[model samples]
Structure formats: C-alpha cells, structure tokens
Target: MLELQDAFARKFHYLRLSVTDVCNFRCQYCLPDGYRPDGRKSFLTLDEIRHITRAFAAMGTNKVRITGGEPSMRRDFTDIIEAVASTPGIRKVATTTNGYRMAERVADWRSAGLDAINVSLDSLDPRMFHQITGQNRFHEVMAGIDAAFTAGFEQVKVNTVLMRGLNDGELGEFLAWIKSSPIQLRFIELMQTGEMDELFERHHVRGAAIKEKLLEAGWQQRVRAHNDGPAEVFWHADYVGEIGLIMPYAQDFCASCNRLRVSALGKLHLCLFGEYGVDLRDLLQSPGQQAALQRRLREALADKKATHFLHQGHSGMTPHLASIGG
Candidate 1:
C-alpha cells in the first residue's frame, strides 16, 4: 500500500473525517452564538464517506476520528461509525463529541463498531460548564461518561480547553476526579481562529505550565504510538487516569504530524491552520474515482507546508474549529 508521506517524510496514518458540521451545543470558544446554517445544510452522504475512508485506508491510514460541531448530532452517526469501522485496513474508529447523546447512544455506537471516544467536558462544576459551553446539560454529559465505561470502554478521554481565568484553577479538581476514574484528561491550549479574537486573548492558557506541574508531581511522559494523536501523554503512579497535553503553539508541536483532516463538505485539509482545502467531493460522487482520489490526495500533499504558521497569526481560511471538525 502507498503511504501518504509529506515532503518532510511524515507518513500520515490517521484521518479526522467530519461527518457533519452541525452541532447542538453553544460552546463559548467554538460557536458561542450557536451553529448557524451557512446555507449548506446537507453534508456528504454515507456512501461518500465510505468511499473516502476506503481510499485513506488503502493508503495505510488506520485511524479515523469522526469529528464535527458535534458528531453525534447526525441521525445516522452509528451507521457512519459502522461504515468506517468495517472498512479494510482501518484499525480504529473514534469520535470527539460534546457527550449530549452519549448516555443513551454510546452503547449503540459501541455496538456499531466505535472503540474509542473523546468527550468535551470543560468544567467539572455544572455552573462553570454551563458558562463555558452555554449549555445546562452538565449532569447529562457526566452521565454519558459513566455510560461510556458501562458500554465497554476501558478508558474515556475528556478534552478540556485550557483557559486562563476559566477552568485554569480547576487542575487540582480535575486531577482528583481522574484519580479514581479511568479517564485521560486532555488539556488543549486555546487557539486563535479567524473569529473569537477577544475570547482567545482573554482565555488562552499556555500548556507548558500544566506540563511543569505534572512533571513536578512525578508524572512521567509516555512514548507516543506510531498512529497517536498530537497529545503528549503523561502517567502517574498513584492515579487511575492519565493526563495529555496538546500544546499546538509549542515550537516543535507539528514535528510529529501524522494526521490529515477532511471536512464534512468533502474538502481535504492538509493542515488545521491551512489556508485552503482541495475539493474531494467531486471525486467522491462515485466509487470508480478511487484511484483518482488517491492520486489527488498524493498530489495535494506535496503542497502541504512543513509546518503551519499559526504562531505568526495566520489562521488561514478557518473561521472556527467546527467548520473543519477541529
């Protein structure tokens, strides 16, 4: 099988495929105003998704993370999971969600072949969670976590966007909670997009501080897997859970780039902060376009920059994270 290698020899093995761009939550950092239709209502069909997954799998991609404004918002989310998981060469099927429907649907999702799950739980405090996500479903989301474990997931990952005055002071609380739960609490640094400049300035917290605290507390950093996401995982001897730091602003953050993103609209994003995308929907119209789609993917990869210039303040065509399933 051909590998999706960039100019720097970074072989891409993971694909972040967005099943839909619509989400129900009104998260402050992402879609504070809530999701407004951009006139493009329908996303790629199930058949289109299947074709893309097969092409990527043929190119040595094994992991597919279904993201969105919130992936489970789609009615056929379980079917989507089944489609990707059944694809040959695909070893893992995961999704990142806000956990709204997780309590009721995760068991079904697990049955449909989803093995890994990541939930966005910004704050343990209900009030704080409501303040951050603009949703009062804090208790419901927590229930979803419990449901995930009951549904056979040994470890559940919780994504917490690190913000200065928001949930920054709750690290101790998070650590305490993780001490007894099999959770991987991930601290993601706040990133600046085309919009949310004010929010970004007010809340953006450096991930290095979290790393320092973890190291001082005797948490050892673990080696990354060949197809792992961009999180520096750390383990503690006394804790039942682990901590992962996703510091995108770090100088060497993109050094181990191994994933590619495809939007719900069927456009290929070489980088999260990339300026534009290569349209793959036209090729996705039929299954016979597989060879062309693979060739196009390879050709487009040659244009991928060695690293994203996000630190230079170039967000590049990305109005927000939800638009491309960040």
Candidate 2:
C-alpha cells in the first residue's frame, strides 16, 4: 500500500511529466535572456516515459499530466498521450501546452483518449502576447484553442500567469473573454522562480490584488468550489464557465499538494518549488531496480516540504518552471 504523509493526509497519486525541456517560445518569465541549461542531454524516449508512467500507475498513481517546454513540440506527442491514456490505473491524462501547434493535432490528441488540455495564454492582445511569449505565433495559439474546442476536449482550461505591470491591467478583459467562452480561465499568481526576480520586478501581480479588482468590477464571486488542486476557483454569476485563482505565492498549497513532477530526463520532483529531484532513468533501465523505484518515490514524497520558501523571498532555489514541468 502507498503510505500517506502526515503533513497532508491526502494520498499522493498525481504526477506531472515533462516531455522536453526545449520550448518553441522563450517566455520572458520562464526563460529570460542569458539563461541556458548546464549541458545538452538526451530527453527520455517514448518507451522510457511510458515505462516509468506505467510503474507509477501500478504503484497507485491515478492522475498524470504531460507537460513540457511545449508538449506539442514533440513529434510523437500523440503517441505518448495514447500510451499514458491506455495505462490501466491512470485515471486522468492531461497536457499543458503553449497551443502553437495544437490546431493541427487537436483531433489526434482527443482521439487518443487524452482527458483534457491546459493552455498557457497570458494575454489576448497580439503585441502584448508577443512581448510576453517572444513569439509571433499568437494567432496560431488562438486558432489551436478553437480547434481543441472543436475536437471536443471535455474541459479546456486556460492558464494565465498574471504579472502586475505586464498583464494585470488586462484581468478584466480576460474575464470578459472567459464570460463569452466555455473554457475555464485560471489566473495564477506570479511566484518567485525561473526569471522570477526580473519578471517580478517587471510584472509580479499578486492574488489579493486580482481578487480586489474582480470584486470592484461588479463580478460577484459564487461559492461553488471545484477540484482538489491548488486553484481557489470562483464563478461569475452571468457566465456558464468559472474563473480560478492559483495563489502559490500569497497562500501556499504545499500542505495539500498531492502532485509530483517527472522531468523529461526521468527525474522525479516532489514539489513544484523543490530544488532537487530523484533520477529514475537508471532504475527504469534495470529490471532489478523496479522495487527500488517505488521505494525512492515514497522517500521523495516523505521528504516533500510542507511549503516552498519562494514566497518567503528566496533565489536560485528551484528550477525554472518550464524545465521542471510547469
């Protein structure tokens, strides 16, 4: 049986897997100028990722999310999705993408039994979007989102990382757009990681400020809560879909964090803000290491910190969100 941690009674079963550390767009917050990995390394093969995921599923993991620098960038993304979706014990198979190439692959993704999609769309304004993501393919992302809807993705969640001076002014505009769309919009508080210091200096918007802005704009917050994730969700009375706030900085969710992260290289990260991870690639390579993998996983979970100190004003502590499977 999977042992439960005392810090948080919730049995840990969810895992976020990063398919690759390479992303098409260099978002300012995620990858600032002059940033590079220590050295070039090979990404986990499709078969390798599948093997580790299947082991985790067998060990009682039910939820799995495929993330990346951009999961869509992988040529065999659909194949990976199908493998995880077909896993017996896996209950949820989702992916977080920049949506640049989703339009062309939405149908393939949906047909592969992928559960849902979470697209990172920080701003709707073309120029602003380009400024934030450093990509001229904003239109492509929008089209991809439409394609996902057409492909019948059950719950298309839009993840917007809010920064104070950067896109905070557009919160109302985003909410207005969400009001008209069926997709759920989630506003995430800017945390101190990645190019966080510089990004924070440039944009770092807080959750409290966002909530105040919403309340002042005549948007009444409905009390209906959804999901066991970190996001504190609320609905607008006039809209069919709801808005969510993931306050990782203001109010930490580490205590109730049931998610674990697996990097593209096969390292397992217990928390989003954690500084270290355990390498599972070697274990996966050896049949004799199967039992060892489970034991290591449990050890990582037990060592999971109650909360991250990023909110407490730390630097160079955790890996970039993109590299760590944001």
lDDT of each: 0.94, 0.78
**Candidate 1 wrong stretches, greater than 4 Å:** none
State the displacement of the C-alpha of residue 73, model 2, in Å, after optimal TM-score superposition. Answer: 1.6
Which tens-of-lDDT digit does each residue in 1-326 have in candidate 1? 78999999999999999988898888888899999987846698999999999999999999999999889988899999999999999999999999999999999999999989999999999999999999999999999999999999999999999788988999999999999899999999999999988999888998998899889989999999989999999999999999999999988988899999999999999999999999999999888999999999999999999888888888889998999999
Query: Candidate 1: which pairs clash?
Result: none
Cα displacement (angstroms), candidate 1, residue 280, comes to 0.4
Alpha-carbon RMSD, each predicted model: 0.7, 2.5
Prediction-by-prediction clash tally: 0, 2
| Ten contiguous residues with the weakest lDDT in model 1 | 35-44
Which candidate ranks first by TM-score, i.e. highest? 1
Q: Candidate 2 on 146-256: residue-level lDDT in tens?
A: 999899875689999887777878866886787878878989877777546766766777787777866776556555322245776676678766778888766546656
